[model samples]
Structure formats: structure tokens, C-alpha cells
Target: MAWLDKLKALFNFELNAPLINITKNSGNSNLGKEYVNSGEKIDILFDNLSKEKQEKLKLILKEKVEEGSKLLEEKSFGLLRELINFQRTKGEDKKVLDFFQNLIPKEDFEALESSLYLRRRFQEKRDVSKLKEDIRTRFGDRGKNISNLCTAGYFENFLMPLFNSSKEGFDNIYNVVVSRSPMAIFVHSAMGEDQITRDIKTGLEVSKKYGIKFLHIHGIGDQNIRTIKRCIYENKELFNYYDKEIFENNGIIIVELIL
Candidate 1:
């Protein structure tokens, strides 16, 4: 019983996982920190459960959390839609839209706007056929993916960092992939599930072996832009195109802690 109690402490059942750290510069960092934290808390809860309850809890926890996450995603998407609509209605000064659009290329901006508007109309009018036709006309085969992006909370926390990063003059990022899902390694490690943790550990190793910076925005939190700024400050080499190099070289020089 003493050994078992000690083992339970390892699970950190009392701990609450960290939330997405939004700041003045980096807005949301949509890293799905909530989702990751939910998983971690469940892991801790699982440790305290009776074996019989643990099995049922797994299914129940996953289901309830997923349902809640779906609703949150919907709400976030609705907020995003409203913001976009407001931007569109504003006459000449599209400063809000311009601020967001500056983070990505013009083509992506156009595609994103078209996709959001089409999906909104479909949701409001409940016309699947019209949506499909618009999809085919505008997006062709990529329509489904586009629709998915529109519905999902893609912009909520993910795109916020770009504003600060761009302002810092580190704007030449070749490609940016914002994962709304947290790394499994982080979840498993938090849960104290050592057996399966090795699998994710290997995956993390693989990413690192390839020198993949794999920017972990959740873990980095509000420090992300500042971290880059510091990297540029400390090393003159990264000053030219730090953002692009950060992505290109897996951020070996700039973001060791985040990776």
C-alpha cells in the first residue's frame, strides 16, 4: 500500500495542466494547450481510479472531452467568422484584415476568406447542394479540406505569434505549420504512463534526430517571439532571416528549449 501510494504521487493527480499563454503581442498561439492539458489531467485521474473504473473512465473521458472540444472549436470558429464579417463590412480601412493577412501570402488570405464565407452561408441557409457547388467551383478537389479549415479553430491560437514575429523583422518564414494538436509525448509523459511513453519518446527522438525544431508553441507560450528575438540578439548569424532559418534548420540555434 505504501509503494502504491508513492506510485500514485508520480501521476501528479493534483496538478492542473497549463493553459495557452496569450499575451499582448502573441494573441492565442492556438496550440491546443487545453486539449493537451485535458489529456494530462485524465492521466492523473486514471491513476486514482479503481482498475474497474479506469477502463470505463478511459472511454468516458475521451468522449466527454472530445464533445467539449468540438463545442469550443465551434465557438472559436463563430468568433472568427464574426471578426471576418466585421472586417468585410468596414469601408476603406481594413486594418484588422490587413494585420492578419500580412502574416501569410495573399493567395492564402483570399482562399481562407472565400472558404469562411461559403461555409457561413451553408450553415445559415442549410443548403448543402449550394455549398458543394461553390466548393467545386472555387476549391475544386481541395474543397473538403478548405471547409474543414473554415470550421475548425485554425486561427484561434495558432496565428497570433506571427504578428509579433513579423514586427520583430523576422518575417521571411518559408512555411509555417501550426499543429492544433499537442505532441503525444507531452501527454503521455504528463500522465505517468511509462509503458506507452517510450513510443512517443522515439517519435520525439526521430524529430530531433532530423534536427526538426518542431516548435512547441504550447510549451513555449508567450516566450516564443521573445525567444526568437533573444536568439537573434545573442547570435548575429540568425539576424538576417531568423524566422525562415528557424523553420528551415529545425531551429537548432534559436529554439532548443521549445523543440
Candidate 2:
């Protein structure tokens, strides 16, 4: 009971996990903090749970989220098709087609337009077939990943600091996405059952209470990872990053928690 109370306190009595510094940063930092909370790991950022068990909150199944995503894509394409048709009927004015440029890539918009014009089902592949077919390491160009989700909410909160910038010190990343929308990280890749809290306050409470700066991480595959290697090349301070393995490689599930 005492340990549980301590855990509760570390979890911030009652609330979803806050960014808790490294939890958002996502690396061995949370692992140490989780252990310091000696604590635990679950999901961070996207799904903040664990604190819910006290009064309780049920996590939505990743499958359900996937199903919903599929449905949305379907509906979105259907509407897109009708609008594309409307644009064709209008001829010289391509307002509908022009509008989509803001939402999707030029190639995707062209493909969708072609599919609509041909009265064919536009194939949508979420796996990012274009980026790389079997990349052992993933980047957040599209699909769900922490590297991309780090762009959410307050941009400066984690991004600027991670990039080693207050007023664009390391890179003018702010300008990179000035007009771009934030990428989405799906639920399937978010949390695992064995992990503890992804709640923000809980992670901060653990580190704040325990006081940790230097973090630890396991599993290294490259002599220099693409992201890190780039930083090293420029001799810039490395930006903190997080990853969790959803699968070992056999299945579609593969997300690696860096810590």
C-alpha cells in the first residue's frame, strides 16, 4: 500500500502522463525515470494511461483506431472523388483540385485525380511504400512515429529545444513547417500493456522528484544513425529522439522505445 501510494504520488496523484520532459523526448530518459518512479513504462505522448486505473479509464483498442482510420480514409476519398468530378465539370476552374494541394502531396493529388477521372478505386497505401519498403529504421515522413508526433501541440515546447534553438539557433526548423500541418501518430504504435504511465506529470514527477539529467538507452544498430549522423556532421548538439518497437520484424508491429 505504501509503495502504491508512492507510485500514485509519482504519477501525480491522478492525471494522464504529461510530457514529463524526456517522456516527450522519448529515450532512455523515460526508462530511467520510469525506473526511478523505479517505476514503469507504458505509452508516452499519444496515449497517456495508467493513472486511470485508480478511478480508471479504458484504453481504446489499437485495432479500433485502425478501423476508424480506414473508415476516415474511405470517406475522405469518396468526398474527394465527388469534388474532383465537380472540378472537371467546371473545366477551366480547378478550385477543388487546387484546394487539395493544401491537404495532400502533388503526386498523391494527381494520382487521386487520375483514379477519379478513370472511375477507378484509388489505392491508398499507409505503409509509405515510397519512403522505403523494408527500412529497419523509420523516419516520420509520414505514418505514425514519435519523430513526427514531436511536432504536435506547442511546437516550441519540445521541438525547438530539441533542435537546440530558442530563436532558431541550430536550425530554422520553425520555418520548415511554417505552413505545414502536424503529422499524426496512430494508436497502434503508441502504448504497450507492460508499460506503466505515459502521463506527462507522472514522468516529470519522477524526474523532478528523483533528479536525473543524463539518461541511458539500449540497442544500437548503426555506427551513426541518420538523424544523429546529420547532427554530428554539422557538429551540432544532438536532438533527443524516442522510439518503441511494435514488432520484432515478422509482423507489422514494430516500435522500439530507445531507452
Best by lDDT: 1
TM-score for each candidate, following the candidate numbering: 0.28, 0.18
Candidate 2 Cα outliers beyond 4 Å, as residue runs: 1-143, 146-151, 154-157, 160-190, 196-259
Whole-model lDDT, model 1: 0.40
TM-score of decoy 1: 0.28
Error of 1 at 243 (Å): 29
Measured by TM-score, the strongest candidate is 1
Candidate 1 ranges beyond 4 A from true positions: 1-96, 122-125, 128-133, 136-146, 165-259
